[model samples]
Target chain A: MAAGEVSSLEDCLEEHLPPAVLQHVWRMLYGKDTRKLDLPKSALTASLEKDFQLKGFGFEAAIEQLRQPRVVRVGLIQNKILLPTDSPVSEQVAALQKRIADIVEVAAMCGVNIVCLQEAWTMPFAFCTREKLPWTEFAESAEDGQTTRFCQELARKYNLVIVSPILERDEFHGDTLWNTAVVISNSGKVLGKTRKNHIPRVGDFNESTYYMEGNTGHKVFQTQFGRIAVNICFGRHHPLNWLMYSINGAEIIFNPCATVGALSEPMWPIEARNAAIANHCFTCGINRVGTEHFKNEFTSADGQKAHHEFGHFYGSSYVAAPDGSRTPGLSRIEDGLLVAELDLNLCRQINDKWAFKMTGRYELYADELAEAVQPNFDPYIVTE
Target chain B: MAAGEVSSLEDCLEEHLPPAVLQHVWRMLYGKDTRKLDLPKSALTASLEKDFQLKGFGFEAAIEQLRQPRVVRVGLIQNKILLPTDSPVSEQVAALQKRIADIVEVAAMCGVNIVCLQEAWTMPFAFCTREKLPWTEFAESAEDGQTTRFCQELARKYNLVIVSPILERDEFHGDTLWNTAVVISNSGKVLGKTRKNHIPRVGDFNESTYYMEGNTGHKVFQTQFGRIAVNICFGRHHPLNWLMYSINGAEIIFNPCATVGALSEPMWPIEARNAAIANHCFTCGINRVGTEHFKNEFTSADGQKAHHEFGHFYGSSYVAAPDGSRTPGLSRIEDGLLVAELDLNLCRQINDKWAFKMTGRYELYADELAEAVQPNFDPYIVTE
Candidate 1:
């Protein structure tokens, strides 16, 4: 379980099981075990070469076997670190940072290699109320911020890919805040960040007030465990955003969401799960668990008794595999890590079985879209 | 088993079983010696209100006591009656009309009350090649057309709601076709038609060739069996299309798709199922089965030797309950009928367990969206 240690499925099975249960355990773990099934070598190699652009001598065959990577235990931190409205910014930051550190320690003990925190883990999502002061203090730079420092130290200590989403303060751009996801590598270095593309301006999720839509296109960051992508909350609703990440060689995507079932309860799980299945990527959705009360009350579409009392965060943090099989853990109520070990080979197996991307007719619609997006262009317009 | 005969669960169970196994059958069917499982009166009442929308009518409670509507049989039809390319227009019309009649006869034998066909079933999906002649010849008027007449007769003969989609040639507008779905009533009348709103012009699913974006918003048609809505293939990708349909009170939404996994295979079942779960509605997806060969060959986004050949349609037709429990029928290679008797009560059971619609924050993004879609009237402003 040490960092950079590579072991075959057979070796891991032998070492992990007792002599009496070894045969049965091996079959369950490696043999047609419903969850971690691998793809054909030829198909896997072609996909890796075509999608990932990985070119080296014997790299194709080597990565093909490795493509359906071994299942690694992943834990989701549904942290509900509430910062009092009246509390000073310094005190709030310190308290939240300490809470995250404690959660990491617990995750490490559980042998979790990848831990994903809920969206904007450092501060309570106060955007719904149009609070300006909270925005001023809560946002931090992805590279030098206190949040990055805490996550980097923890990642290095535990040898885990710490997915930390925060209201990123852009020091280069007039200190403007962007909804960003920072991937802290296992070696404590800051990997590249992906900004949220489709920002929500609907319901109690008034994300437009505090941060603008991200300009950076979809990107996948290479890590020790896998090439991962982060589609922060609202971006999950768009298929293209997920597609961009998938085509760019993202094996796993994390969707970290704040707020509750009240604002997007019906759409929860569905958005993230669909993104996973469509992209042929393993997706983990980490959501806040408790009912965090905000200082504002807002009316809903129909004049119902709707308030910004950050509706009950139905804590259904789940892991959806590439084949559409799901492990739904901890829903409605709070306080627990939802963990699942996903075999990367299923991605290739599913892609082969389904072959959606390969069969897709993109040429038919390309010209039409190019025409439609043009100003004052009408599809129905005939000659003269 | 006779049509129009609303057989009780007891009678159906008894008739389908042998006398030798009557004792075991009785316990399994009735769940008690008294021939009843006393369900909570509230559960029954809620089921009635939620499923049938029978306000203050305690019919469900009485039905539960009588064990009615528990195991109602249903059937789904996935078809591909390709429009004749070589034959005369009249010949093409006759051939397709005859095919529809044959399919209806098959459905009648199976005792299907609701038969949903693939999108634009009467004609081939010529949108991929932009062959204008096919569009002009195949597109029919929704009110009085060959397609409508066929559906109307089939509905009356079978005493069923024949949900048919057609390339609607709008007579009001000069040479305009709308992607329309016509719901034919059992009494040989057109109940309503829902036009597809979010038209996709991306890749090979070029729907814009024959039809324009639907101006009519999402609507739920109240039928004798249930309230239902129609969201055509491309429309499935948009979440708003689903919300609009659900908010307007659709209990079930039919997503009739033409494209298979090749173009966007991974997204097939995912989009529709998510919409159903998010809206707390029963969603059924019907897709065409088998491969289609078009008259043209086109390259994909990346320079791959692609063809305009209709990608192999992976027919994973499925029905998803409101509880997010999905029963996928056949895959791409199979051509068959999938039947399932859905307990309408499960809709209420799921909604009660996960009241997403009732609890979601719906109004927060109103202003932000309103601002985003606003037209820029500054005519003098120069672009890059």
Candidate 2:
């Protein structure tokens, strides 16, 4: 503050600051960088409107807000758990519990606000052979299940949202099992559940034996951190599912899958990435790694090895940006968490840059597609 | 022949047959069915060796002794021309006449083969800018220049292969120039070309003032009832470029393009589809999409667009098989023809059952790609 001496703060702002620099400044001024930036709701109402012009709009303001230094970090625990029939049920549950605990500890150390487990993470993928014992023993009720209690305890300890998927036994129905994903809040409360929509019975995998298609439409739950949507396995293939999640105001969508190899190995990433690109939302594809074998092998018509050797699961877990660029060097195998300091402003940046959502020919094929999905619908029959 | 008694020719060979039965068999043997049917070498080899287990290997023995087919139709065309420019007179002449005609008449269409024309079939794509005059004098080169004369004479006289692009001078390419395409057959007949690439310049529409990109590359040329490749303009964006042609080998590869899209667009199809799903033998891309412009606009950076609105040409035309999947698509649209046709049999059955080749890694990167062309390379690079 001497005469003829340039002030450091004034010099920094005047030296043609880059957007990143301005963002960091905004973060320093505001404790929470994204979504909590102090500004009038509209430009007309802003007190220092001229100074606020540099911030652009709400999404940009949110990104700048998030860039502020904060301790809350999140990581997802994506893994595949398969229980062989030969193993005792008690022993399998104990092993899974330990694994879950270890992953939660890792997340806590990384300061992750949430750690999402893969779909049906505790049970082995047993639908391949329609075996009765695996389904009967593995299915659990979300309300009173041992797995739910275990996850709740972990969430309380780590102070994190723990998303757990299970084979839920429906009490109201005729004891039918549902492919359900339960979201446990930081304070250890069951937020609610979403059943998977699409049930695939293609090739060797037959999921219909244990679980029916999810009836609940897409839902986004508001947590302390942000609004998030949970899409279970197989639902990722359908674009409409992602759209429904986006329309519900989800900023981030988590897709957890338990798919094994053969032709499917290549298609795993495509589903999640497409959802992100098309919806302009950040997407994480958490897949279960490793392999499992079933006691019985189904035979194909050609007498070939029909039951997949618990299909070789390639663990190419990744995080994709709204711009469709993925974090390279992500591990294809081995258990590790991939993290990136994402500038959330990129969501809108990409949206404005590509404008795919706005320009998309949504109405062109909407009617034709609706007819195709609905049952017994005939467009050719003109009822005037 | 007595009632309840059957006189069979095969029975005569097995048991002691009467002379009348043998003589009657001999008389029946000299019928039209006794002669073998002719088929293509690939079809016959595939049927007998793969399907029927035939033993003969030599073409003559397979045809005469084993009664297999030998004919396998193929076509080859070469293009050699530089994008037209108002510099280095000798080089321009060589490009227009000797070098280009040598490849077209001497190399490609000498035999009864299919041939393709280079991009811009006439002058260079120098109209990438706003300069007038150079493009204003465009003419029906297919009728006025040596290109048409050579093609007509070759097709009629030698029963040669021919496809030529010409500058159809009209109200379009400014006052007189029009981007045109012409397809010719072995009998020296014109098959007509479609004008429609519809070049859109986000930063520079210099092309609108000069000539338009052709609209169609969809038509299939037929000569001697055999299909041929006829991709003109920038018709590669449509996947139908390969799908329609590959439904049957049509037994040739021909791509003629003018330059001016993002550097990546031209290269994507040039390199990707050649190795696409099935490995077809003989694939070529001809280009006039190179650099050269007059001086209405100057003072731009070297290789930057001049006020005259033409760009400097990059001439790299290539012929490849399914083997080199990584070869970058040709860069620098120039005047050149790429010619090669090994055997249609090479692509036929191999790509039939194994759809993997056609499918390529489409699913792998399908969801991961945002804008096919990014202004900056930062997103695709691995920063870590």
Candidate 3:
């Protein structure tokens, strides 16, 4: 991080909060990633160790030794709605930019190397209204947009790998639009980008009304800190989506999402953890907080023009380890940052232990899925 | 159900359990299946409805209306190890046979239409030993195996659809071995078999040393109750395995596994539930109970000749609905039966609302996965 940026961050901190409270908040968020602050052995881990003991010949000691050192600190920022639904896109983007800048300084001070923002973090989740005119204003060029430029400055200032998810307008490609996550490197470089591959058509997400699913095959962005992948939002529900990212050798994958409690809370707690376990990697699931009420009533599946507030955005974000244990909800109703010191080496350790990828029988499944994706594929072969 | 089978089941109940206790046990396991029982609104159902509201236009009421009829009673049996590890395969087989028969009688009295056994239920999970001779003794022909034949009679006697997972030997095909599940219909005939495609190579499971991964593409068995699929044991770790089963129209997919708490307990609770939500199906994840102590010390990755048991086969079996809500753990230690009344129509209802499968962009994923399965595929197009 540059001296100028560090001073600016400190200056902002000094101006915005009291020294005592700022110190406490920074410690609260960055405390674990500081490398000096050791976390207590989780009960789940002790139970797993004791219960799955390799006894008689005493191999449990070896398993314990394997779990030490080699950690990567990742920070997940689940932001709340930063502006009202009717705010101008420029003002909305500016407000979120300032908020995230403050967060990035705090996250960097906390020693977080990687920080991820929620999906479409700059503007209100106004897609629930099914109105086109105003929300379209939020879409900007992913490469040169003001939002990406703002993130670049933060990335450079914090020496952080920032995953900034936004509604993108591809001006070079026929003005095409996409749900994209721009990966900004520590050197203020745009490393690459990943688009949301699976789009939802059900309920409040008539996302097809805005943009189609992405064309990028499963992609992993190779960064200096770690190899990372982005499975934006609805893609989390697709197991294959998660599998493909793992197959691409991602040690840490972030799911930047904007889902409501009523829309997918039951599945919210299940999919990311399972993907982390099954794929032998660390997964951070981040969702935005608060509710967005629509002014206009829209016709929906219930055959009525009805007004509805978008379901509550639960924002209970957490990080899951390769071994399947996850952090409890960080903040269910408030904006918060969740950080963890992940031993990136744990990915290899768990993979070596589980060998899920090696034993995954990709060839067999590939053949089956190859046939399955055919236009006339049959789901069942019934024999009388 | 056939009159003879009903009468025999009644006779067994009359001969063994008293009327009051039997009724209580029946209600405990099978109450949800009996439409007349009028279950109090289930916490799982109420939670799911509350968490995944179809908002905007009040269509959740219609979804509730859709969930009214169309229920299937399925039973999951996570049996405890019934014999010593060093015991003769025949003795072990007989011991489990009697135990399973007793359990099946209880399951029938409980009104379970479909009952599934744990993976290779007739014998010990001795694959961890990496020794062939004794474990090979457990292998039998899938078509005429003693285990299948045993289950055949039980299925006929109970008028039950029995899914019997076993170590299969194809005698006619050069005695090739497979981890297989044989689906026996209510009439006591072998419907078909689905082989476990994904084989484990990590930890205690060097399954490839005994049997290669199965070549059979995903197949669903159409039965009197509903379409079913079996993803035997290690296949549970692969999400694509579960997805293929769902795409093949499996309403109830049974994951009969032998995973221990040490190796995958954290994952056990998460995977099947997520698979249920992602695939829009009912999933039963069953594991064996008790410690299967090995007579010989096996060499494991921990660099020691270990006389370790294959960890505790934590029998925390449960059922997950399509919308991702799940039943509580049946038993973590003792052998028990978990029965759930699945509204099979919920698969379509959830799919209709989520439209995940319908809008999954199978064509695009198929093209990518087809390329991905090639011998020389790479996940990144790296650039400087």
Candidate 4:
């Protein structure tokens, strides 16, 4: 039958195909794929009964209610409000404000006590465009800005602790630009802000042109629901940024990001989860979705026309517990809100069991990094 | 029917059950399970096809032969040698030596150029026993001890760069003890060694009693295969330990560990993968399998009779590429050899694309950690 089939196909097309190629085609038709997939629990599980034993029991509901006073249901919003590059700054901000308010209302309905927006949630990620004046108009003072007032109103109305990340213009400090997250308490008080410590300089992320590295040290704000900290956008790429927040007593650390699918997709699922497990803290990584196209063509450092259309913002935001169990992520193509109940006691459970911080040789690393960061420092020479 | 069925089973057990208990059982039977799983792929996928795309593609074979000169196949050995706590040190060492030779021969057949064993591979993880005299007999000099000499012979025979981790007693340095990895070159030369920087204080890993923190600043050994670094066992818990190695130009960092399932199973799948992605380097996580039982029960710091049998080692050893694609892991309950052909240039490909090292804000972190590690430093002061 195989020989007959080859002859039958020969009438349809000339036998110009290589003999080896025909052999490969024949094998492809009859061979079973031997490439094994290695997904945990899901890809190769025989039954749900075996899967539960493999992953341990599901999250306990009885112990959860015992610690209800210490639990805060935190919400993360990954909103993708698309606007044209030539859209007015006011229109862009207004569109995001409207969309975020709707999403925050949904979060409130879902009983989220604390909510955080994406990095620079009020504006498009136009730093890649590299145009100074147009983007500068979107920056406002952290205090008494429209975004701050809006978040304060939401916090007061919903009795929620709202974290609003924004592009700030430090008017008192010579209009210095900063990537900042403003913490609004439930009582509408504008608490202190934590600036992003790390900035991106690779490919389309040319954020270094707009702001320098943060001068504000890692700070955990005391809120009514929980001790909260913000590691804005690019700061998620650095583990040290998250470590400092955990050291300063952050029960829940929110990484509000504006990264895209192709640029950070590979790393998006890994870094924050590792930080949550290693540092013994609950980490929420929120990223925006949808594609934002720029009208003006801008050149990257490598001279690529990076402003045509930024990559998809891939809004697969999720909450990772200290014990490494994570909530199902939000959608990758739509504006979504992910709410997770965080038990502050689980942090202590992980810390007491793993004791990474206790076993960590912090002093040695502190001294080494202090020296390693020096301009002339070099430590790779191996003496045999 | 739901109400009727509840009344039917309810006739017998409901009369004895407390109202709260009956309500809980009824809810448990009929309630929608809300414990959402956030695996990168589906919690339960239809096929392995969707899982592969979601996890990014596995190791690519098409990119192999183009740069044949830059490829080095490395193998990691995760051996679970269960020995009685009272066994003679010589007998245990001899047993591990025989089994390891067979595994190394298999690795050679698989074309591995560099090979590494699990942490302190020659003897049982007797730290859980906490009996000093019995385990101390297992310690040998790192220079030319029997373990080193054994590895040298294997390196010479197989033409392999072998990393042998053992409890090292530094006879020349006042008989000081350390957990060290001795690196042997292909021609049987002792290249160098790196001591375990971090030692666990929690659970069964009572290693601090035997050895203090290492003084060897993160050093990379220039080997015939690649520039290698060792972050033995507990060092895997600390991100800075890995960042230092990557900063020192280690293309491949081996984390040979003896951790167990209950204490670290969650973090096990995370830390090494994140280190590979964030640092733009290849990470090899090797953990021993099987359970090691102790005859003499030991007291934990919290005063529990903490010794009996340690948790399952769960030997899911894996190789995480710089692009964040991990090879399929080894068996969970068998002595295994995992060989992976690595493309050294992928490190640069990821680094150039991610630019984490360039954008890492080293100076700021150096200053911050330098202050944070001070003896008097306390950042968790709650004024309220």
Candidate 5:
């Protein structure tokens, strides 16, 4: 790291917070790259790098004679909402569209095949504000939403598969709102959508006030690049969320989240990396950057006074390979894009070495969990 | 970190090895304590600290007037086999017993309620050598094994619940051998055994050559201090292995492991820590330290030449809390003990905050795994 960066990080250490509350502080002190998988920067990327923090890595695998290497470049983009919460919904959408389009163009120049945006990238993270009027207006149809149309145009122009997580207004049965990810193919066609299964009611994440838990099962979309799945935001905390996606033949799972430093920064580095090792699949953790301030004040119900600003949305986006090696994260305080080139063959290679699936003994766990769910179930507790 | 330690760690980075092969090298560069939960060194522990690297931390929790705090001080012991592999079996057992006895005495003085030793603590990790004669001689009955008998006396004397991982020779059932952890209660009675469910076939872990998969299910023993379970060695890699123990009502799980650096150092820090977070339980990862050379050389079937020593054991024992915070590890090259004082109430506190159990949706996964085990079952794969 540069001397200036070290001095800035040292400033964060002087905040005088308790250790548990500042769990991610000590790691920020190092301010050095943990792994060295440097991706060569091109002229196009270099020009855009000045606008935002753009960094990348490549996951290398051994050569196999019979099987050709499946090299898929995945780009994770984390950005801030440019407008305030009280701004017009269309204006907010337009600002994010333009900002993300520039980053996607840079990713295309850097040869990113699949691109993923941070959770609910179309509007401000206003759920914490607990206001339904201006916030719910941002929700759009998943099939042909304004965000989807924008991503579709970019996907076709750049010849890239784009994953757009947005607030969905489902119009089929009822006008029910949902947290969903729309997968647009390189051909500009809407492939399908996966809803966020788990919902959070903790702290300032009053997400349950807007939408209930999703109905969609763990779904993997097979694109030309790779088999991908999305575990949105709070779902990353649940290991089974990652496992079910892997069981469904997803080689790459993306955790597009909008969590803050106080709530989940310490867990951010660990969950995705651990998922990669346990599931024998590549994992991408993309968190939204910058603090989003709302028009109304919010209280977390934890004895703290009401405040207008939500905690800092730590933007340490990075990728973890199937072998448990991970790339260094983007800046915590800056909008950034992390591009990772992964060899799909590493998934099977790690599986062969670890034999996790073969030795997983799914049958035993099936029986155990089955027995556990019973109304009069007895836990296998051996008490003296 | 001291200047001497930093210089020594820097020296290890100079050894030429590919990035993938030396995954743990970068973390060693920062030899500073990652978390600050320092336990005060008592004079009793200070005397024994001179013999080996002894370090500890304490887990603090919120105060509740309705419920009394259940603080359990747990000690993890990791040590190398003091004698050569070719040494007399009786002499080897005697040496290890005396060394472990001294460590347990220190733990008693430090007010540890439970103590756990590394896997196959009384024997050299001989399974890697794929030899049978001298190693098989080390196996004894779990109920009355020489190692268990020794631990029984220590438990009675110190009033400590001891978990001893040993090679169990089930003489009553065709003299079958199994990797088992015999849990001795605080009163010194044998409290049954939990075997290593997942046997590894990767690298030099030729465990299947000695015994088949364990028959004993994931068992959590409700001792006086805490409800504890043992997920021995290779079982750490499987998330379900940890889940079953938690579902069985374990507040703390001890992973008594015997792993080498090259094969698992990168994964060692992650698996146990992830388990603690996912299961809402305190986890102790205890690994044997130092390299044990065998009399005969063995080949790992990976085109490598025959070798006398299984790679460095890489002790690095640590304790992880349910809140995702972990203590700095013990030395990578020294026999050490990690004592952690944990309030069992923190497990429930984390569970309430995360609501992992309520939101886990176990019934869905149970059915998914049940379908997965069928011969004609189709995996939930989506293809273009």
Candidate 6:
């Protein structure tokens, strides 16, 4: 339960269980994470050793289609801050950019039409420190931030849609701060940006100390590849967040998150997959991989002692399809790029089979939610 | 994929895989289904060889509590039709009642405070046959029906609460037929009823043809043991159905289902478990076992050939706690009783830890849903 650890008991059990048994269990439990996509090795991929792990898989659907399958290749990147928390912010940003550029190049080689980075990928996840001077320096304008510029160049060069999540400094609204995702189209133009609607107050997140909830509504971006929406980090916990994106005609929803293992590992697999099933859309769940340490000690209200580091950010990023099938996830201990090819037509096909939209009865729920939110609302409990 | 079969490929794989590997895969994929609850062997349990499978597990939680833990023992029964689908309606009902009596007796002996049976437990699942004669004959009045009266006597004798999901014949309302769960209190009184809100239209489930949407809102019944709600059958597919029960102060939600494997096997685990996580409540997912053969052929919208029976109803009943842990599921091919002891205190404790209620922003979602339900509503999509 300590910081920088991913379940002491699980570690102990992993050591005791046979390797074949562990593999069998995970394969049975998670299904085939993904059938290994045998991509011909490129110069960039072959040159890099274990430093940058690149994985690819495909989610095939069996729905009847009149038109040709609209297969869109998507990439998700989970990486650690290359520099220490005490390192210079500029140096940290530069190191992350260089590492990400290498991975994105590999994704492009593997024909990824769209790609996304982890939440706040440009800098260390240093909100746990609650320090204003140093961490606040990482925030920049989403319109033309250094990170946005870098992603734009890659997106245009590779002809890929890029979703870049960042710490935003909104100067127009009296210099407000927000957690935002900057969507860049394949043509290198800045498509509209969407902010994280939900903020976390639990654990050592201390995100509420930095910024309030986002003002932007749920916005799905229309790109040449597909209609995509980003549900950043903590918003994955709310089913309504996912539902709104689906209601807005989003074909694929990306959840770029920064969460540790002890707090959320058990829930990591279930939530996004459930969202994909409920919404009849594709969902990509991406997480930061390594433990993030702060120069200052922090304490969570869970009675744990004050610690200088958040627990390990277990990276098990994967893609879930509309048909209730998912690709295997990336490694929990490594920085990896998970590339998945999806047929966009599967979205409508799943809806055709399940009829979630037709059977949902959205009007009744709208009334129920409206009534429940009333000040004098009484829960419909049958006391009799 | 044939009627009365679970999965052809899964069966083939099971034949090939070593038993140890299969066990490892199941244990790994499902985690520990449940640590075996060593109950003192009873006469009824001892007498039944493999006819009745009795299983139990305990879900323990760790949280700061001021009051003593409120431990409630719950029992879920997944059963098979005791008679052939074409049998006399009265004989079919009598045969099922005799079988249920034995199961309820075992549950009472296991100290079950509240028990729930699978959907339409007293009759064969003949809805797929789309025949109105024998199936309609099985429908009875909720108040003085033969099934409700039988449950009332058992409830009073054992001082237990029972949830009987039955095909209800509403005598006053034009002899309307509906899928209802009659809540029988410990004193053998009818504690009102809640109907299945969502009806399935896919696969071989011809539910919408038989009944319309339930008039009863998501009703949480306050019993002596705990506040409970029944989201019968297809309601599990809708996240809002589960949320309304939680919003109405339900501590435990029972999903009594009669679905086939080909249609919903992949979804069986994810939906209810995700509900328990999203709602911060305990969810018991119960499914009917075995396949019922009909004299007439049935054809679904799917391209499969006409069949005499619906596909297998793979029974994998299990309990999911507020925390992300779940007990192992029951058998897929057997009639079984899964009893789990839960501390109701875990409900609020999870809410305290996750604060899902506080951060959920229900008002925002209420407005979003309201706008979405409007006839001329425009989705909040970003095209620029």
Best-performing candidate as measured by TM-score = 6
For model 1, residues B1-384, the per-residue Cα lDDT tens digits are 012221122333344445545443332211223212233355345334322110110111113454356433344556554454545666766776765566555555545567777787776666777667744687888988878988888889888887888888888888688889988877778888888876765556666656777866566777766667888887776555665566666777888888754355545656787777767777778787656656566554445676756566656576766654555344444444455445666566556545554433332222222222335411111111
Give the per-residue Cα lDDT of candidate 2 at B97.
57
Q: Which lDDT tens digits does candidate 3 get at residues A1-384?
A: 011111112223334455555543233222211222332334224323322110000001112454565446677887666666677778878888877776666567567789999999888877777788788889988888899899998888888889999999988888887999998888898888889999888777878888888987788987777889999999999888888888878888899999875467667767888889889888989998776766676655656567667666767687777766666455445566666667687788778777887877676666777788777887765654
Give the Å shift of residue A345 in candidate 2. 1.6
lDDT (Cα, 0-100) at B255 in candidate 1: 86
Model 4 CA deviation exceeding 4 Å by range: A1-69, A82-86, A297-307, B1-69, B82-87, B174-176, B296-307, B378-384
lDDT of 5 by residue, B1-384 (tens): 111221112123333334533332222222112333355466246536547777767877789889999999999998878888899999999999999998888788778899999999999998888889989999989998778889999999999999999999998888889999999999999988989999999888999888877888888899999899999998988888999899889999999999976677667777888899889999999999887888798998889899898877878888888877777678777778788888999999989888788878888888888887889877665554
* lDDT tens readout by residue for model 1, A1-384: 012212112333344445645533322111222333233344335434322111111001013543455556666777565566457777877887877776666566555678888898877777767778855688888987988998999998998988899889998998798999888888888886778876776566777777876866656777767677887887665554565567667778888887554345545556677767666778877777666665656664445786756566656676766655455344445445555666667677667645555533332233333333455644331110
Candidate 6 segments whose C-alpha is farther than 4 A from its true place: A1-36, A47-50, A63-65, B1-36, B47-50, B63-65
**Model 2 chain B poorest ten-residue lDDT run:** B53-62
Model 4: pairs clashing at backbone N, Cα or C within 3 Å: none
Ranking by lDDT: 6, 5, 4, 3, 1, 2
- Provide the DockQ value for model 5: 0.38
- Which CAPRI tier for candidate 5? acceptable
lDDT score, candidate 2, position B232: 51
Task: Count residue pairs with overlapping backbones in model 3.
Answer: 3
Off by over 4 Å in 5: A1-50, B1-50
Give interface RMSD, every candidate, in order.
15.0, 26.2, 13.3, 16.7, 7.8, 4.8
lDDT to native, each model: 0.61, 0.49, 0.73, 0.73, 0.82, 0.84
Write down the TM-score of every candidate. Answer: 0.54, 0.52, 0.82, 0.80, 0.91, 0.93
Mind giving the per-residue lDDT tens digits that candidate 6 earns over A1-384? 123332222243354456655453334344444556777578235526647667778877665647778899999999888888889989988998998898888888888998999999888888887788788889989999888999889988999999999999999998988999999999998997999988988777888898998878889999998899999999998999999999999999999999987677777888899999999999999999887777778777768898888878888888988877787777677788888889899899889888888999999999999999899999988875
lDDT top scorer: 6
For model 5, state the Cα shift of residue B54 in Å: 1.3
Q: What is the alpha-carbon lDDT of model 3 when measured against the actual structure? A: 0.73
User: Across residues A35-83, which tens digit of lDDT does each residue of candidate 2 receive?
Assistant: 3223224422331322111111112313355355222244555444535
Which of the numbered candidates is closest to the native, going by highest DockQ? 6
DockQ of each: 0.07, 0.02, 0.26, 0.20, 0.38, 0.46
lDDT per residue, candidate 3, B240-316, as tens digits? 88988898889889999888655676577677878888898889888887778888887777666666577777676
Q: Write down the TM-score for model 6.
A: 0.93
The residue-by-residue lDDT of candidate 6 on B1-384, one tens digit each, is: 123342222343354456655454333334433555766588245427537777788876665557777889999999888778788989999999988888888888888999999999989888887778878988999999989999999999999999999999999998999999999999999998999999888877887878889999999999999999999988998999999999999999999999876677767788899999999999999999987888888888678888887878888898988877787777777788888999899898889878788888889999999999899999988875
lDDT of 1 at B240: 55
